[model samples]
Target: MLEEAEFDRDDAAPIDMLESYFAAHGWSHERDDDEIVAKVKGSWAEYELRAIWREDDNVLQFLAFPDVRVADERRATIYETMGLVNEQLWIGHFELWSTSGILLYRHAAMIDGEGGGTLTLDQAEMLIESAIDECERFYPVFQFVLWGGKTPKEAIAASLIETQGEA
Candidate 1:
């Protein structure tokens, strides 16, 4: 499990460690108070992912909002598809903001107490990489459903179908 790893906090905020990790990878990010926001470019879209450190709650919240907006007419279908997608996801889950009709992926990593748990660089990288990869892989499926008028099952099936060059 992603959250099962023991991180050595060393009495520092997890958010600070996250900032350093991003810097080490040459990814430019902005830190605002307790939150860090970074823009990531993917194959299909540019994503803005935010990591917020909730010190009092001992949790690090990560959120990614794709550039696509769920059309009002397609909201129902998208919601249904998201439910199915969430079931297959191991770490984070996709959710729709009802008011804005925006789809977002969210995952929270628990930091045990003030000095019990630590967020290692590897674990942090895993969390970010998994989220970005999943979004990149499924983004096309979302477009198929919203614009191509395909059913949820059909969309998923089409997305999972991989093509290979002649070998």
Candidate 2:
């Protein structure tokens, strides 16, 4: 059985690290009120990378898709199947960060049955990249990036995100 973990919003925001990561990689960060949003678009329409940092720990990231938008569609089904009525599952990489600048967890939109647990920074990086590599099976062209602590939403989202392309 999975052990229940405590989630504190004041100690786990991954956006701080993300901002540093992007800047180190030559991406710029644009502040938008409480959210910091950024986009990198290449010649190919599908080569765009969009990301947003909201509050202390909510980071949403997404890669543009040339084909059907799989995240939105899959998320709708998952929400309906699980009977979630209060939240909207938008397409892309949706992540919620806690306050400590650590990636409490993350997941993609649409692909349900995500799996996650507390992880070190290195572990989080590896898992996130692995999740992206597996996206082809579920959404021909989809990539989601997320950052967040273990809130209920984050937990559920993480599970669904991990299950996206599993056999």
Clashes of each: 2, 20
Q: Which ranges in model 1 have alpha carbons more than 4 Å from their true place?
A: 1-12, 114-117, 162-167
* TM-score list, all predictions: 0.86, 0.30
**Residue 165 error for model 2, in Å?**
22
Give, for candidate 1, the lowest lDDT window spanning 10 residues.
1-10
Give the local distance difference test score of model 1: 0.80
Alpha-carbon lDDT of model 2: 0.33
Per-candidate Cα lDDT values, in order, are 0.80, 0.33
* Per-residue accuracy of model 1 over 80-117 as CA lDDT, tens digit each: 89987887889999998888888888999997775644
